[model samples]
Target: MAKRQPRDTLPTHIAQWRDQVRRDYGIEDAPGLILLEQAALALHRAEQARELLAKDGLVTRDRFDQPKPHPAAVIARDAEASFRAALRDLQLDVEPARPVGRPPGV
Candidate 1:
């Protein structure tokens, strides 16, 4: 019998997702990580769904004539929505507030 190898847990951690977001978005600040973390799980699922759809051409229904989005596409769509919403909610974090008053210690 073959010995079972330990499963890699990197994919399940938030830091991994954070790293992915950084690489994907070329983010350089903590705010970007924070935003991605908000929708980490959904983003991960969306990526997985996209990969599945790309590779398998998954068609949930073959008996019907009407064309429809693949199940993976649906998952990707919902996940993308969640990801975008998270980013939208954190827009302020990405754009720093400008100081309206005079310079300090002028």
Candidate 2:
């Protein structure tokens, strides 16, 4: 009998599946690129939110009172909190926030 791979190797399998989907769906060029770009943007925003929360310890309304905050900051904060909560529920290691001395340019 062949040895089975660990579940941790599933990501490679999933990527192959996604590649098959792209081929089967005939995904190419502009529209496909746009979708891929959007996915990348979403992932970038999620990472930003995660970092913000991890640095600031909490999202406060005051954070929005700054001279300029991207309009998406609030949405990002909410999403980050939800993600963290979900991680906690799943018994995953939730990264605790590290205190940042002061707001930027303060």
Where is the poorest 10-residue window by lDDT in model 2?
6-15
lDDT of 1 at 14: 57
Q: Write the per-residue lDDT of candidate 1 for residues 4-106, one digit (tens) a residue.
A: 9883233656557567667876877777666667677667778888999989786655566666668888889998888778877655344477898988997
Query: How badly does each model clash, as a count of residue pairs?
Result: 0, 0
Report the Cα lDDT for residue 12, model 2: 48
Off by over 4 Å in 2: 1-26, 61-73, 77-106
lDDT of 2 by residue, 1-106 (tens): 9998763222344446445645665657676644533433444456666677667655344555745454357768665556455434434344767777986787
Cα miss at 83, model 1 (Å)?
0.4
TM-score of each: 0.49, 0.36
Model 1, residue 95: C-alpha shift (Å)? 11
